[model samples]
Target chain A: MILWNIWLTQDYFEKQNTILTYSAVISKAYQKEEVISYEKWSECQNYYTNPENLDFLYSIPVTLAILALREFSDDISRRTET
Target chain B: MSIETIAKAIGSILQDTYSRNYGLSKGFNLMEKEIALSSYHLLMRYADNDEDKNEIIATMIHMLSAPFSDHEIDKITQYVREIFFKQYPDEAKRVWLALIKYSNYKKANPSFYRYQDEDSLNKAEENEEKFVQQISSDKNLTLDLSEISLEKSEAYLLARAFVITPYDTDDKDFSNFLNHILPIVIGDLTKVEDYSYNRTRESRKFHHESISDIEQYLANLFLEANFENSKSIFTTLVNSLSGNAQRQRFGRDDLFEFVSTTLDYFVLKLYDNGNLKIDP
Candidate 1:
């Protein structure tokens, strides 16, 4: 059930606008360290993809900025209440 | 012997030699002789073994003898022998072997002594002094864009961002945050996403763009999202690129003021709209 919810969340985030979406966050991670090799980026993506790293996810400045947006904040509030 | 002992012996020998025979007691010549003697003494004392010590001693003697007449050379050699030979018999043998071997080598390869001579050394010293004066005066001391290209500027921006992060922030979490945010900041300001298709091939490209107003652009992005510490972060980002501007000595502060002016207006705007949240 938890895995299903996580997958649903990931899918939902992926479907949003690319500029402030999960893809943007991941692209930012890959682009942050210009010297990071493709393999290193893939490894980091896998690491963050895990549900256990949610705190790691929430810690990002961009994540916080995105969450501050009314769309994301309202969506999160609605999800949490349900 | 310890370095101090060796240094003292060398100093005394040079002083006595200068007084008795060399007559190098005034002006640039005297200063050059003193510097050379000190440098040779340092090399001889720290040499790996007897062979290296002999080579260094030979080089020193050959270079020092270049301006001296045969009569003066004989007098200085006799003076050196009386003080140094008696105190160090083994060192005397090494010195003798070095003089014989390297004097022949010096004669055979005269071109090799070009920089080892006084004129070249004096010229080098003059250049170094000029460089020091240039930096101290901060005149024509601005770093060129060629020296720090766009890629390097981006790297410095990221490094500066990491440096200005709060000291108390958790390292892993902050690192993760930086890794996730810096790219977005860089990309938004510097590049735009574009896709191209050629029959069966489709490719994505990031088209580069130059920002005319970094502060204004950042303000729009940060103020729209209501970023915490946006002013401070934007200031650092602007400051990081200040070196790219010519005459950076005063230009940096001017650029910083511009960033402050541009960002502070947004801060005021957000406050007026009752959107500013002071999260304690």
Candidate 2:
């Protein structure tokens, strides 16, 4: 779960700074039917809601990931506005 | 299933998650460049001798070249050269000779300033392209060397002497090809170790040796390349430089002059082919 959070944070940082909009793994996930949305993020939400998807410890990383992404996005937005 | 089962599941989940995200990258190119340079400095601090320094430098270059532009590689190489030159003259010369990236990027911007990020690299590339297009392309300078008729004259003989000429070719065509290639070759010859700086006997000998090496490379390249014009006097020059025929005994200054002229042909060919070397 700690490792998953780190990976998510790294992914967010890469996307925020890069010129590329989409990543291939996300596309591959969608192609494999592991993700169903064009945005490639909808599967995570579905997993969160599904009771059968009970890796309860994984929630810790998932929550931290959401908060970190929000803070990062907010920081970028504030900087851009300034 | 108790604590052991839970730990195993966690480990499995972590491995799966990390594996999925392993190749997710974009901005990492700039990050990778930064890391490579920092690693070089760290390596330099520990490098004991000239051999160790050169081996590490070469390893660093081989590792990072895939992720960076040709210009970026040259920039890093120049930095490494400056650092190595104080202690390792021979190793430095080897590195300088081997660096033959055929781009007008350096000619466009001579500064060795490091780019801060991807934005700056892109901006530098844009500015360089604009500069190169302005300076290089528009001249449209056409040469008609045959009209000069320097046939059998010292200038013609001097130029002709450098040419490999293993096979037969039109004298006029060979002259025209040589005329096209000499300038770029001379520019490169003077770059590694400027012979004019001291004008001493030793420097002249060193320069001559360097030019011979350059000529060997030109010979090798001409034999390797698939030229569009097969019937070109280039074919004759290529065959001569092919080094397959009996090696000609060329003296000091004459060898330098001839190799300089011949290598210029190779240089022009390389420059023309530079467009095909797409950046990462």
Candidate 3:
């Protein structure tokens, strides 16, 4: 079960990278006079399919901040509840 | 001589050696040397076979393996040796043979010899200092994220990625839903401070919720959006939040302020790209 979850996380990260790649390509094409090709879009999709690249790309601080905010929110909720 | 007498003789020899060679006023140093000498002496006695030598040797080895301070070593050595060696000349030849054999065995076992060496002792001392420092730095040291289980840490990280991502929807209700869930995602990544009220008074403000709360909320929202179904909107949101947080050391108010600003920036960017519509 744990192994399955880890694999799932890896999958999510890969998909995230695909989105990143697509955005990058679209943005670049917008600035360039050269025509964007379907081949480049396909390349971006291929990059997203690979999970290994996204492992190091995950952020720590954002996670910590979100956790902090969640706690603050909970405290606010508790205060209101009381 | 009896085993007790032999132990006594060894103890006396060590005490005399400590007094004669190392100054007694250096109490800790003298005690440490006494323990080492007594340990060697006990092992020697076991090999001599005044009694069930193997059992005695095993017990002594276990004792030596335990953590011992220099002062405790001195006191314990005195008791161990005195209890073991009481009779002397009659068992003298056996004691000598035991010492020789044991010494030879130790020489052959290089690893064991190294473990009992001064270098190993010094390394143990260094490790003890590091442990003390680690404990001292965070009174709630046991609950610190660095000390948490890897699974929890990873869960927290995943939740964090989910919360910081700005949600965009053509519908107002869905964006509001994402905003509402964001706090729960943040909660899952926090660790509870374990110090007393006075000690952790500062940290108490941080540990109100479990990391899973935020993680589960963000995960569900992401899944609802078919995060994989969309292009890099989710990834960009995670990256933006992470990037901003990394660039600044935020104060208490800064967290809320940063999130608001980040949301505004993303909304503007998405609106310019014609991918998002704002009702304001």
Candidate 4:
């Protein structure tokens, strides 16, 4: 099932989407050192297919971005549900 | 946390994901919870308890989802503010600042640290620097992309291909050599599907061309070498070609680099085994 999720992710990214795959997520985890740098993580996530070069991509991030497209708020009082 | 703990969490999430799949007929059943859960699986490895694990994972997923949104960033800030801030103010402050830094960094440059390993990236940079140095010193230095006359380059063959021309000096037939040997070396590969470097246009082209070039170069090399069991290796590469061809879609420059690097190492093996047949 983990492998299946990974395959789906590879397929999704290969098709040029942002949805994270399991393998990519693991690869991202491999990148996180002392800090959780999403910038570094995003840099590693590939949204295309390239079998000869797999090192440039990783396997994790958000999928809710597909749905929640809201304006960025400034005040903490104007932000969040949970 | 222990690997067993993380594995257990993964198992639980997989079960949740599995149960979610019952009603869906065509599309996948993955939702925010599942995606968030999977993303946190990495952070879950750091969790000492389920409570902290769940909260941290939720915060990470939320941050990942709306990385740029002040609200998402605040949600994580809130997580730090209410929970850790009260318990460990210093640590909480550090984390909160780190979170903000991370969010800003993502917004500013969503693409950094794309390298597979620092070592390789460093080596590539060093090679580039040396290439510039050499080109500066001897502007006449052109790459030798011919068949490489294996006997003449026996020293280079014995060492790494980099010892001769480390840069993307396209003059050497190293790429072609890699292309030739990969079909034979394909057997030792455990997971061909891991190749997912497809980031940019040039990288994708390299990935696709690398695989396609390998097949083409190997066929040419086989015909040229005309070894005793050339037919067997030739047949094998052709048989294995379909998988790589399919993998070409997932190819990237690093994947091509990987193939090239693996070829550099494996060619030595082939030579020692007398399979490379370094004649003429």
Which whole-number lDDT from 0 to 100 does residue B203 have in model 3? Answer: 36
lDDT of 4 by residue, B1-280 (tens): 1223233434444444335434433122222234433333334333456455435533432232232323233333333333444444333333332332232323333332555888877876565434333322332333343423222222111112211111122322333444443442353232343345443321212123223333333433443444543445455544664555545455342434444543454455456457756531
Model 2 interface RMSD, in angstroms? 18.1
Better of 2 and 4 by DockQ: 4
In model 1, state the lDDT of residue B183. 40
Q: What docking grade applies to model 1?
A: incorrect
The TM-score between candidate 4 and the true structure equals 0.19
Candidate that would win on TM-score: 2
* Candidate 2 RMSD to the correct structure: 20.6
Q: Write the per-residue lDDT of candidate 1 for residues A1-82, one digit (tens) a residue.
A: 9999999999766533322444344445434532434344334445444544333223232222222221233433333322
Q: Chain A structural similarity (TM-score) per candidate?
A: 0.29, 0.27, 0.41, 0.23
TM-scores, each model vs. reference: 0.20, 0.23, 0.18, 0.19
- State the lDDT of candidate 1 residue by residue for B1-280, as single tens digits: 1233223434544555645545533222232233233334334334557555545554444333333434443334433334444444344434433333332333333332257788887776565435333322231222222322222233222222222222122333333433444443443332222333231112111112112123333444455533443544554565545543543352233334545655675576567656556311
- Order of candidates by lDDT, top first? 1, 2, 3, 4
Against the native chain B, each candidate's TM-score is 0.23, 0.24, 0.19, 0.22
Better of 1 and 2 by TM-score: 2
Q: Which numbered prediction scores highest in DockQ against the true structure?
A: 4
Give the per-residue Cα lDDT of candidate 1 at A70: 16
By TM-score, the candidates rank as 2, 1, 4, 3
Return model 1's CA RMSD, one decimal.
Answer: 32.1
lDDT score for residue B57 of model 3: 40
